[model samples]
Target chain A: MNVIDHVRDMAAAGLHSNVRIISSLLLTMSTNNPELFSPSQKYQLLVYHADAIFHDKEYRNAACKYNMALQQKKVLSKTTKVRPSSTGGTTSALQAQNLPSEIEVKYKIAECYTILKLDKDAISVLEGIPSRQRTPKINMMLANLYRKAGQERSAVTSYKEVLRQCPLALDAIIGLLSLSVKGAEVASMTMDVIQSIPNLDWLSVWIKAHAFTHGGDNQRCGTWKHFGI
Target chain B: MNVIDHVRDMAAAGLHSNVRIISSLLLTMSTNNPELFSPSQKYQLLVYHADAIFHDKEYRNAACKYNMALQQKKVLSKTTKVRPSSTGGTTSALQAQNLPSEIEVKYKIAECYTILKLDKDAISVLEGIPSRQRTPKINMMLANLYRKAGQERSAVTSYKEVLRQCPLALDAIIGLLSLSVKGAEVASMTMDVIQSIPNLDWLSVWIKAHAFTHGGDNQRCGTWKHFGI
Candidate 1:
């Protein structure tokens, strides 16, 4: 089998710990056949390497590799001179269509920063995203970053934006609920959101129970408990 | 190869996503030859199944299986009348030495509770452990559970116990530092603890730099930045 096939097999088998070996093999193969891969293929390989690093919790290394992949895409786009797609800008449209979006790469980098406890860098990277391109997921992440950075008011605003777009967004609801975890009156609001998420497991029931209990809404708490906690 | 051997190969290959397949195979094998396995082997097989479940993130199911394994051990010990060892106790001494401790099983259950967002249950499970049996790791977990349950003072006390036992305990240091993450006085203390963790990277340097900057300790922040953050 080819080296790429072998790497694919390893990844398919979930052997992430073999990433360093696969990377080294790729390096050797590339040196042997300089023209074996296209720039986009090389970019994809770098992304795979970065994902492996990210999974292994080598956040800083993963972020650096992701940045390299992004840069490579920029270079590819300039050389290709492809027309802009209907959705994104001319520059990004010319880049690898199969690879993750620029915003997604930046988001992943910011996640790595967060894992490394660099909240400031995470927020800076997240906030640098063009407002028009910010998806609901991005808003949720920005909310998380803001919360971690101790920007509670900003987090609330971002989280509300997420909820406004996708009212059933579990992460956003949890984010808001966590703010008032020790307080009251958010119970009714939380209960409304909780209805959107399916599979009312013990976690879900316990959340409502805890919320109502804390909210001093004994009637609601009784109803939740009666539903079988 | 035997069923157990096949299961071992599956686990070694990191194919935990095939847990259900393994579980079914184990079941069929056991039913085909009920007497083929000894009592200890049966217990071991149950532990293996539970481990598969645990690795698959089936926390609720895994906790139940772990509990069943523990109960099986209790029954086995009663029937065999095993003696206590220097390391563990009467009931657990009869168990496989490599298998997790009784306290460890309880800890794992508490971890599942934490993941389910059942902080209260987690605290209760953790607190149920006898003080004499609570190791440094257990204390750290208890501290984390306390922190999650919003019992900050208790969490602080438990974290200090961890630090007292092993001054280089990273989790304990991080736990305490996270409490005063925005404060100044703890920066020096954090730096002192940071020295204990080896292979310090830019991430570590950056954290200290950010902390000192937030703490308004210009001298320390300058020193950290000067080191090439």
Candidate 2:
């Protein structure tokens, strides 16, 4: 089997350190002999190495590798466009290959930054993603980092975005409440999303309970017991 | 769409709280009318409810639901055997439906127990998994729980099992060395597993560095700079 297959097999078998070591060796070889692999193959190798390093908790090195992989991907795309016929593969085939998107790479980079306690860097990386393409996971993460960084307004906006996409995200609701957003307003935001569900009145009650608890309204919090928590 | 479809779509959309609430409602309806679903369907519902609850951070309730799911799966397998023709589906079809295995359910139960600070319960649940079927994840969790519960010998055995399966499991190696196992001995254990690698003499150096750090032998640890970590 080729070295890539060996690396993949080791990864599948959960020999993560071995995968990291072997992938690093392959990456070094590719660096020394650039003609050894096509641009797409080089990008894949860098991502594999980065993933293994990430799994091994070498976040700083993993982030560097992920950045390198991103650059290689850009090169692959540019080369594909400039000389489409020379690449020896159809563009459709290239698209079908399970390559990670730019957003995913950035998300991973942000994850490494988060783990390294560079919240500002993580936030910046996440913010680079266009708002139209931001998933709830991305919004929630940004909300959390914003809250941690004392960017209350941005945090509130991000949390609201999360609630818009996923009304049942309890953490996002709590995040908004903790930022002094009104409990009633936050609970109402979920109303449209949950209208289809029968007998979901208890959800609003649950949200109110969280809000009351966060706002220190002990009397209203006590009333939730009547609904049988 | 049916309630099940709704619940699934909500789950896919990351509306975990909605999934939990709706699944609970359906579960209540199914309880009132036992004929509403087949044994396997009931098992699937219980697992869905348990997963949603798990995601919602309600560990105690999630554990209960998972246990109930396991019981339902038992009923499913039993019913399948007693009247295979009456179930309206082939046994293989039932098997192909992505139901969680016994080991997987036990792992989830153990995870909840761990999160709830019930380490003893977690250890017992993990221990119930037959020895031969224990994966590295199970063994690693069991090892950590054993260490926390002051069962050093059992922890050592489990960690060793982990290292045996995946020699590059750095945490397990560190786990062994932390229990006073010699660095050289731990390093030697990985030799047979990693013999295929062309240049891996640095692995022993890496292990020795960890050992020196753990043993507080700073003098020897300083020499690792020669290898360029």
Candidate 3:
């Protein structure tokens, strides 16, 4: 049937939300303005609409939307194309490509593997990122992966690397600090951090005390009040 | 000995990097100005320095630092008393006098438990957060947790919930989308997304296609090429 007939039938069949109609029109328009959609709108339909469907328990439809999104991203990343525009304006090259830079793509791939519970695969993808270019975010992810995989030694290293990469990376710092302080080594360099940051000294001490309690250092933990923190 | 004396001695002892001086001074300051540090700085020191200590296999020192931080946090949290400032100004409460109000705290607590290999504890901490307030972040954590626990039903539900909460939450949407779009459903929602947002059609297709591929739907995955996204 023609697009119009399909629309009429869909309307007649009560499947005429703007989402459905727009989706149908999008298919027709794809022949022309292939790259005309915005990420936000695409996200809304592919991600959001699909999510709503998923939430409504329509797993099949939701899956289709997600698959469609990924397909679009792959094409943008691997191919270069010239497509026509819907407006009368000359079809300027649409650069709102779904393809992220190599680094971003790698990160996304890692994230996907992690989501799939393929820890080894996720680690492999993350490990492929050249060290220098590994941002604090990636380091954080690595730390999480290590921790999740029960690689405490590696996780510790990644967490430290995060701090070295971004001395001000609060999340990483907190993770590290919480670790040491909880271990009851307040006299360690973690204490130096509490000292330097000024505002968090008390918290550092409190966490330290908790660590002491956990570590059987009741002597230090009980004296928390004496220190006046 | 006075703080300056300690610095001089440390330098004489071949510990002259600004890092050492800063660390020593920070340690001293932490003793007096428990509330003078910022949370980020405090967390940083805990992570970087404390992590080094822990990894140096200096569990003893690491525990000390961790204890100190925890003590400080607790005092700031449970106590109402204001800490005196170094400049003799009115009391400045640098530490977190109150519990963390952000969702990250839950995540951090979860991290702590994870590090301790207390999976049940970590899960419980996360479960305490109100669902509405839970971010895409916590969803990922919960998904991982459920996945690890081999609760496939729960894991899938959590993943699906993430999509429902954020239709645009690509991570979750892609996971579920792959399921339905593996040639199971007629064309992934790429067309629909593009139709919804005409200006950036490829983005819609890209994300869906990506989701489809990730979901392991090799068949419908090819449909993405049809759109040339």
Give all candidates' CA lDDT scores.
Answer: 0.62, 0.78, 0.51
Candidate maximizing DockQ: 2
| Interface CA root-mean-square deviation for model 1 | 17.7
Best by TM-score: 2
- A-chain TM-score, model 1: 0.64
**Can you give the DockQ of every candidate in the order shown?**
0.02, 0.14, 0.03
Q: Write the per-residue lDDT of candidate 3 for residues A126-226, one digit (tens) a residue.
A: 88778888876678788878877877777778877765644434345445544453344333434554466424445455455556655666676775784
lDDT, candidate 3, B175-223, per-residue tens:
4443443422322433453365325444466565766677776787885
Residue B89's lDDT in candidate 1: 69
Model 1 vs. true fold: TM: 0.41
Candidate 2 lDDT, A47-77, residue by residue in tens: 7778888876789999999999989988988
For model 3, what is the alpha-carbon lDDT of residue B40?
35
Task: Put down candidate 2 lDDT per residue, B1-108, tens digits, no spaces.
Answer: 334554555566655554666577568767877987677767777877888888767999999999999888889888877876763676657553655566877888
Q: Each model's RMSD to truth, in Å?
A: 18.6, 7.3, 16.0
Question: Model 3, chain A: how large is the TM-score?
Answer: 0.47
Over the stretch A54-77, how does candidate 1's per-residue lDDT look in tens digits? Answer: 867799999998888788778666
Identify the runs in model 3 with alpha carbons over 4 angstroms from their true place: A1-229, B1-25, B28-71, B81-125, B128-132, B153-157, B177-196, B199-229
- Which should have the higher DockQ, number 1 or number 3? 3
Best by lDDT: 2
Better of 1 and 2 by lDDT: 2
lDDT of 1 by residue, B86-139 (tens): 345654554456444667777778777778887788788888888778777678
Report the number of clashing residue pairs per model: 0, 0, 85
